[model samples]
Target: MSTAMAPEPVDNGGDARTRRSIARAVLANPTMVTFGALAVIILAFSALAPGLFTQGSNFVQLAQNVAILTVVSVGTTFVIITAGVDLSIPSGIVLGQVFAVQALKLLPLGEGTTAFDATANQTTALSVLVAVTAALLGGLIIGLINGVVVAYLRVPPLLATLGTLGAGLGVALILQDGVNSATYALDPVGNGALIAGIPNLIPIALVVVIAGFVLLHLSVFGRHTYAIGSNPEAARRVGINVERHLLKVYVLGGVASGLAGFLSLSYFSTTSIGGFSTANLQAITAVALGGTSLFGGVGSIIGTLIGVWIPAVLKNGFIITGVQPYWQDVAVGFVLIAAVWFDQLRRRSRDRG
Candidate 1:
């Protein structure tokens, strides 16, 4: 009887049924879920303060406020998809601004002097170009450092980037001390236009986001990146150039950071060294919270865009609603943790099967 019983514990239908259930759940409309959340937030805001929520001025302000963070978050989505983190973004942004300002100070400030006064600086576009270039270069250099440290030195991304975070902060401080600079005034000439009605920076951000989406979703290189992140050893076994591709991804992230910094300079008209550490962390959290698996290879630009904006929207909404500013931070922290926890649960369930 025992031998007969042991002969076969044959195919049970249980596993197949469980798999079907999971497949069905996964196939449900995710877009509706995202949109629903956005709607709830909008409705909540509008109900609380109809005028603030509906005003055109408020809408424009929100757009301008989110632009920098949205751009940075877009770049970070690429890195996190590869199961990596970039902690140096804040520093990179600060350094770019500093470098850009200093470059402007050096270029023909006056006939005999080495620095430009407020009047001279206010009228020139050259300084803006120089500043933007410096920002881009600074970001590229930081990204390369990140790649070299992670890919070659075998440093963990978290630890390596943390080191860069500190180093970058130090560099920013040095630049700040060296310059003894004051605020840069925004140039009013052609303020209402770009090369046309659309600002150059807006077009630049759109192009970056669109091109990044295309590269990540539609290109063979994107597939290879996902393959590498999903399983590095397997990717290499299939002859994917893992190291080179990773380096490129890191550099691209840096370039994105640099561009974000440039936009920020335009937005603020002044560089503040003290108030951006949180910005970098928030961008990372936004990417992670947007349903992008921290384990890698499962996220989208559209999701990241949603993730980035939700927090910005929430903060802006709170300000409009007279919620204590500190509460916004607490709320964001909770949202980030909750999202990560949910993601973990999802991953575990998938693994169990």
Candidate 2:
């Protein structure tokens, strides 16, 4: 109205500065952004569903839902850090579960022959040892095969893991006659609570998180892992023994899957042979969404933990909010793709600068 034309439209470059600031902040601590997203989801879901999503019991349930996943993802986080994939994680987990159950049969548990007929009272220390050992060995074997094929035989990581995925599951099926077995040998570990009666799974997961954090973030082994993923040739020239280190990495991943299998059996009191078919994809998605580059050399235990929770919250929230179940997959897919794209973009920017 005053015909001043807003002083010819001031252009102070504040928008550019703000964007640059955000980019710098994100570049410095990418995990923070993912955590922020998780926080937002929690808040949004809590708001949308009110008391349902914010209940203490629901959170405990949420923790239980993700505990096994958190355990399994520890080694997976390392694998991705080395720029490798372990598609056989689910099979490895199932094998562990199967091994634990079969080992239980060798004990005097007196099962009544039903799929879930075993009781918690039948659990014994010897039975526990057998189950744990069997599960760990089963998972470790799968990991070893993957490591050998990928490291020495020059098979691509994807193909090697894919082969093991089917093979491991097949072995499990053969051992169990394609049926999930039951034993409460791990019931104490699975359902027992410590410190204020928290579910045992959460504490077990917390321990794994601590161990994984130490292994991946604070040790030379972790450094070697990042170096290998960042530049294998350079890592090799530096005497990193890329092949052996990779083998160890795959082994570690297998061990983690095996541990997850044991924990899963403990929690469910049965082998969930058909329950975790998509678990590998879920682990990959969590790792990717937590800012680990698919191309490798970037990730963290904390990030993976948060990544595990995002979808868990979404599914739980969606149910509470009456959203269609399929939308959860659609939402998670979009988030994962966006994360990977942003990761690629960040990588390009780093290379350029």
- Model number with the top lDDT: 2
Clashes of 2: 0
Off by over 4 Å in 1: 1-32, 113-125, 178-180, 183-204
Q: Write the per-residue lDDT of candidate 2 for residues 97-177, one digit (tens) a residue.
A: 998877677665344452223567655667777788989998999999999998899899999999999999999999988
lDDT of 1 at 43: 84
Using TM-score, give the best candidate's number.
Answer: 2
> RMSD of model 2, in Å?
8.3
Show the lowest summed lDDT stretch of 10 residues, model 1. Answer: 183-192
Using Cα atoms with residue i matched to residue i, what is each candidate's TM-score against the true structure? Answer: 0.83, 0.90
Against the true structure, candidate 2 reaches a TM-score of 0.90
lDDT of 2 at 124: 63
Writing each residue's lDDT as its tens digit, candidate 1 over 163-189 gives 887887788788778443443533332
> Which pairs in model 2 have colliding backbones?
none
